[model samples]
Target: MSTSTAEGRLLRYVDALQEAFAQEMARDESVFLFGLDVDDHKSIQGSTRGLLQEFGPERVFTTPLSEDAMTGMAIGAAMAGMRPIHVHIRMDFLLLCMNQLVNIAAKAHSMYGGSVKVPLVVRSMVGKSWGQGAQHSQALHSLFMHIPGLKIVAPSNAHDAKGCMIAAIRDDNPVLVMEHRLLYGTEAYVPEAPFEVRPGRARVVGPGDDITVVAISNMVPECLRARDLVAEVGISAEVIDPVWLQPLDIDSLLASARRTRRLLVADNAWLPCGASAEIIAAVLERAGPDAGIMVRRIGFAPVTCPPSPPLEAAFYPNPGTVASAIHAMVRPAAPAWQPDPERTRLSYQSSFCGPF
Candidate 1:
């Protein structure tokens, strides 16, 4: 059900993640939660609030300060018959456990010819500001995207967050769900019960003519705002939200591009060869040069996101930038105004060429 108000509920993304984990744990005894201070509940962003109380310590067990040890433990636990959900406060921290994710969990199914499966869920945070800086603020989903046997999920609103989170827990393959650092308080109308949001499918939020904008995660909200801003200037643009990044919804992209004949990509990733590059390239391959499609990506500038407010203001692409870009893309000529017949009679002779 949709809310009547203009603004949606403000449920934090961490809250959404915690609810998904708890729902799955209660649904299936095979599910278990693991991470640092998961038992603490209120200390870290209050994401794990009341989880330990319901599931108790066994399911919501805490880990020592060892990424390698716990990562290996999670992989072994998954292999030995336990669905362990590993939580990282920040995604950049996962790099220390890359070997376990890429080598063991990712390669195990293929190495053994599908004899085993690693149904593990790894949830991490990607913070750009809030003083987290380069170490903690990096949106490094591309790193996991490089690995073959990984299911990458990044949901924009509360509904997709819940749906994708439940889907990740049920997935037989390794799933990495990245929670945008800034979207913590963002919320939408999520189904009351657990739902499955199939991977590789994109959701078309708004339908329009002329242009199709492919947005990812938080980019979805930005696109919506941009759509409204551009509409004021008389250009209608469709917005597509790709919930799943890896098994991307190329079909939706192609369909929208073919329909609109123009594409504007908005993503959190940096320009050049990020996910935007791949999406744009796919359109070119399918439609060719005469497809009448032109793609301009809105994302973080080439420079890094410094903690400084001014630098970040310029670096991050907001709705204003998207709106401005849309205006430039569709620069309509102003309508010609006519004067009263009596007043225009004199001008008829002189107005032939006013400049002359």
Candidate 2:
């Protein structure tokens, strides 16, 4: 669909994903969907809800629980000119397929001297919910970003979610698209037809001057909440969502940093040597050290996520935590603004009910 026509509709994040799959599958004969319960009633948190009905069991089918073998099969299909969209219920499960992903799928094109293309899309979910605990709640984009031949994208909103998924499906290389579990229900204006958000771009969600807040995946919404809270205290925060992590738009990030002179990275992963650390280093290197810029990072606490509800709440950084961190970094002596505890608790849509 054209850009003008796409703006005429509104959609939930999960609906946008379903539309992307339906549109692409309708448009191309090579595209196929497979993973655990992709065609079931639950439909992988409803992202793949209606795919099987539209495309039939041959094109959209569920797979066995063998991540390694299934991933290898998808890689083989992609190598032979089939476009495969592999879905994982949890990003943590991606660890089981690292050998196929990092070694084979990621290295195929380069290892073969560009003689073949992988045209593979791996869709995985990463976010915290219902005390999912340490094993299931990891947002490990940093690990995939370290590899050379893979493209990694984490969309925060519905519009980008649809656009990026289309781009990944069409791209002739291996792409890992990470979706935040909490963002599946968030609604936004999306184009009715297919579109591409384009990889390697940084979108400034909230434009401000005092500081530039770079957020990733689910953290983008929390940062927006923080922006509103900080505004009451006269701190204007510019929020930048790095939609594509692999080919990161450093130019846009540096531009925001130069104008604000302060940057805070809010990522959903851990702190040490994480995406936050990499962004800080890149910004400082390009923006220059003499600029006297201040940089801080907020992410998962430097420990395993706790299973208890209250401890899990403390473990993950919420809007309140983000706002408090900004308040402290921007002004040391000012009275801290306290957000309502009830408001900080993250809520899921009624449709979202399980790990599947």
Candidate 3:
């Protein structure tokens, strides 16, 4: 076992994920990981690197290209006193196993009257990666959020990524840890020891009183940058990252919205019936329409993701767009303005070189 480096050190998001898996498997023998290409040379973009060798084929083997069967296997393993981490290379593929996940794994505990425990972790990545197009780049977290028994989390940074992964593994119910591919390269300070970030908690990225910006997954960093950009124009934007999507931290969001009297939800997916809509609905329902909070949502354009770089650029939201939206909501009477594109070029587009 590795000693705890509680002082912490900077680790990339991918490294943090790998560390979490490594530590957890070492700590609990029953905890095993398996997924499509999980033991391959790429190792799910290096997140599963060194895991197969350390744990051997029995615990860290790869599955066939069958999502449904593999998911069933994971559920069966979980029910029989084992913690299984099933990795889906792309969240898009998870759709093929919806029945196993939503119908069986999700409902087994309640259906069996608490006698059966399905402690499972499904790790999947979302977002555009080298023009993967609509088929591969979709963020379908909202679909799982609609389900009753599953817990969904989309961690934005290395620290939260590691903590959330650990938490999901230890959770008794089935948990989905959605990772935005673009975040894998990002780095943050993480402790060497295992740690769990309690779910249903929201982290305030930037503090302000003017407006509340609730960003999901990859949008967290973009919104943080947007916060700084809006500051130049004298608009104080409070940015909040809802780390867990299922059990949303509505109280934190409502408190922030109540303070600012304005709320902007920026999600990685589309606006209609999405996480953003759910959040806005929750705040409005809880705070009441009498709260008089101004709300707006920004996400993917209402169309399928495009493969071309130019179309892809238009499809996704960036710091410039977020800042412009914030400006419109806070200073509606002011002249229309947006940050210079040259200065605010999307960082993920430039850094991501992927075929995974």
Candidate 4:
């Protein structure tokens, strides 16, 4: 679980995280880790594996069930010159600590007139699988993006995950690192040393001129699938992954939208004043009244998430659905579904387990 590697090891999403934690704790004597089940046998789904034995109880331990009290303790520790990394098994549980996170941790530096800093890292899992239902599965990046002074980092690959985790630990403010549950099994080439993926930047994953398909978190992989499906129909789409949500890189998005003359935002949340809406508004503001850019938003259906598999399929958008949307946008009269649904639908990896 050492962060130092031979430069090009293929690491899964969970492995990248463990390496980042090991490297940071070893580098900074003042850095410590804490959270629910962080040091237990489960090890927070293996992201904190081997850390307890390596760092010992003082540096790595679990907390009580009280999120608000535990969050306050982390904030106090940060103010006292110690970097604290707090882990949440699910982002849904973060709702219990909103007052401390949004009001105190997010506003400390500004309130103290830059006299103090809160170098706090809050890592939470975000995604859906195996009928976990609504309580355990929610991607609340859009919700946190609306609040100021909070840096939200949702890395889509192993490289970005390791880099962003390291960056968040060293940052002088409260940063939220959101990890998708299904992405844990995804493997990619990552460097062995710790690095930083700066916040407020967007990465252009695929290049095209017909449309700009903006995605975040788990939607990134789905967008890649949609790109291939759309390519078969002679549609070229440029995909953009906004790793940092709060201080969004509007410049890159506007550039893509201007060139493509069409934009589609795919977010993993409901679509009422969500991330998709925010992006569309920003693009329109810069493009002006006469701009012919046609904008559309794709997200979860406006209803409570159902438990049935068939209903869930219709609720969540997949590559097939995304490709169909692009087809309809490019040619309004085109059919929504292809000749066969079985061949078009993409499935998740077998390694994905039900919410624990």
TM-score of each model, paired residue for residue: 0.86, 0.94, 0.97, 0.95
- Model 4 scores a TM of 0.95
> Which of candidates 2 and 4 is the stronger one according to lDDT?
2
lDDT of 4 at 279: 89
Candidate 1: list runs displaced more than 4 Å. Answer: 1-12, 332-356
User: What are the per-residue Cα lDDT tens digits for candidate 3 across 133-154?
Assistant: 9888889999999998999999
- Our model 3 lands, by Cα RMSD against the true structure, at 3.0
CA displacement after TM-score superposition, residue 265 of candidate 4 (Å): 0.3
Question: What value of lDDT does candidate 2 attain over all alpha carbons?
Answer: 0.88
lDDT of 3 at 347: 72
Better of 1 and 2 by TM-score: 2
Model 2 ranges with Cα > 4 A deviation: 1-6, 333-337, 342-356
Q: Which stretches of candidate 3 lie over 4 Å from their true place?
A: 1-7
In candidate 2 the C-alpha lDDT for residue 6 amounts to 38
Q: Cα lDDT of all candidates, in order? A: 0.75, 0.88, 0.92, 0.86
Clashing residue pairs, backbone N/CA/C < 3 A, model 2: 6-191, 6-192
Best by the TM-score measure: 3
TM-score of 1: 0.86
Model 1: how far is 235 from its true place, Å? 1.1
